[model samples]
Target: METNATTNENLNMYEKAENYTKTSLELIKLKTVSATADVLSTLTSRIAVGAVVAFFTLFLNIGLSLWIGKELGEYYYGFFALAVFYLLVAVILHKTQHKLIKTPIGNMIVSSILKESKN
Candidate 1:
């Protein structure tokens, strides 16, 4: 009778461990999904805002170029000046892209995930 009771207790312990493991896995999955959704939503909204700003910048630059061209007596010269300015800007960005862009983006993603986990 004592041996049977001991076996039964061990079986119950095993069942409890199994239940705990399953519950832990489910929680992990839920957290992963929540973090992913948070990051994606944040990125989507930023992209939308960026698109609007891009359009505004495009029109503003075009108008400025035309005005500059009128002042210079040739529209193409305005464009050439703008092109040179942008070329310098592009080179600077390329040189510092890892520091300016990649690190910030990586930190943002990590923070988003940590924020979700905390919640």
Candidate 2:
């Protein structure tokens, strides 16, 4: 009878240990997944904002091209000027955006905010 009792206690202890291990692993997995999701969300938001800015810039360029064409009396010449201006804007914006993304603190802050919001 005593031996049986001892065996039962040992089995319970093993079961508890197994359960604890599983829970710890699950928690780690959840944290990892959350962190990855936060990173992706932040990056996606940044890209989306960049796209919106680019779109507005393009629209502005088109409007300016039409305005210039009307004022200068030649649509093609005004369009060429607008094209050069648009190229300049694109280059500057691209360089600025690239530098911003490369900054470590930018991602850290963005990811942290996203993670906090998710919680």
Candidate 3:
């Protein structure tokens, strides 16, 4: 009778541990899914907005280039001037990209993952 009672207690403990392990795994999965969804949604919205802004900037630049060319007496000259201006800007950005671009993006990803869910 004593052995039987001890065996039963051990079996109950085993069941409880199994339940705890499964529940913990499920919680981790839920957290991972929630974080991933949050990051993807934010990125999707930003990309959409970025695309719209890019189109606007492109058209504006084209118009400005034509105006500049008209003033310079040649269309290609305006484009060449704009190209040189952009080349300078690109060089500046390349020099500071780690500070201005990479760090901010990395921080944003980390913050997004660490952010607590309202639920």
Candidate 4:
């Protein structure tokens, strides 16, 4: 009888431990899902805003190029100048991309994840 009671107690303890582990795992899964959703939402918003800005920039550049062409009496020259400007900007961005963009973005993402974990 004494041995049976001891064995039953051990079984109960094991079951409780298993239950705790399962609950902890579920909580981790939920946190992962929440963090992923938050990141996706942020990225979606950024992409949408970026698309709008790009659309506006395209029209603005065309207007400016045409204006420049009118001023210079050469439409092609205006477009050429705009192209050159963009090329220079692209080069600069390529050279400084890690410093100017990637690190900041990475840090923001990490911080966001950490903040979610804290909450």
Candidate 5:
């Protein structure tokens, strides 16, 4: 009777351990899913906004070039002027690329991941 009782207790403990392990795995899986979902949603929204902004800028540039051409009385000269302006801007951006782009983007990604972890 004593041996039987001891065996039963051990079996009960084994079952509890197994249950705890399974629960822990499920919790991890849930957190992983939540974090993945958060990142994907953020990316989707950013892409949508970027698309809208790009189109807006393109149309705005076209309008400005047309107006400049009208003022100067030659369409291609206006485009040439705009192109020069863009080249200057591109050069400036290239010079400051790391400071203007990389650090901020890295910070944003880290913040997003940390924020998701908190949730």
Candidate 6:
């Protein structure tokens, strides 16, 4: 009878562990989808803002460069400045992407999963 009880307890524990594993996997799937959506939304917003800014900036830069090039009699220098501006924008955006990846939402997902498992 004692052996039977021990065997039954072990079976129960095994079932619980299996269920937990399945639940954890499902949670991971959901988190993956959620994270993707979040990143997409962030990128979309940034792109929308960048589109508007870029439109105006492009025209303004063109006018300014032409004026500067005419005054200095060196169009290549004006073009170089434009290139540097674009490179700076790219660098800033790359940093922003890194920061976003390390955000609270990402941390919360892992922390919540750990908290759930502890329970």
lDDT of each: 0.95, 0.82, 0.93, 0.94, 0.89, 0.78
Clashing pairs in 2: none
Local accuracy of candidate 1 as per-residue lDDT tens digits, 13-111: 999999999999999999999999999999999999999999998998898888888899999888887888899999999999999999999999999
Task: Mark the 10 consecutive residues where model 6 has the least summed lDDT.
Answer: 110-119
TM-score-better candidate, 3 vs 5: 3
Per-residue lDDT tens digits for candidate 5, residues 24-44, read 999888877877787788889
Which prediction has the highest TM-score against the true structure? 4
Task: Give residue 71's lDDT in candidate 4 (0 to 100).
Answer: 85
TM match of model 2 to true structure: 0.59
Residue 23 of model 1 has an lDDT of: 100
Provide the clashing-pair count of each candidate structure. Answer: 0, 0, 0, 0, 0, 0
Better of 2 and 3 by TM-score: 3
Per-residue lDDT of candidate 6, residues 2-63 (tens digit): 99999999999999999999999998887766666656666688789999999998899998
Model 4 worst lDDT window (10 residues): 69-78
Local error of candidate 6 at 8, Å? 1.8
Off by over 4 Å in 6: 65-119
For each of the candidates, the C-alpha root-mean-square deviation to the true structure, in angstroms, is 1.1, 4.3, 1.6, 0.9, 2.0, 6.7
TM-score of each: 0.94, 0.59, 0.93, 0.96, 0.82, 0.51
- Residue pairs clashing, model 4: none
Candidate 3 per-residue lDDT over residues 1-119, each given as its tens digit: 99999999999999999999999999888989999999999999999999999999899889989999999999988889899999999999999999999999999999998884444
lDDT for each residue of candidate 4 in 39-119, tens digit (9 for 90 to 100): 889989999999999999999999999988888899977888899999999999999999999999999899888878998
What candidate 5 gets wrong by more than 4 Å, as runs, is none
Q: Rank the candidates by lDDT, best first.
A: 1, 4, 3, 5, 2, 6
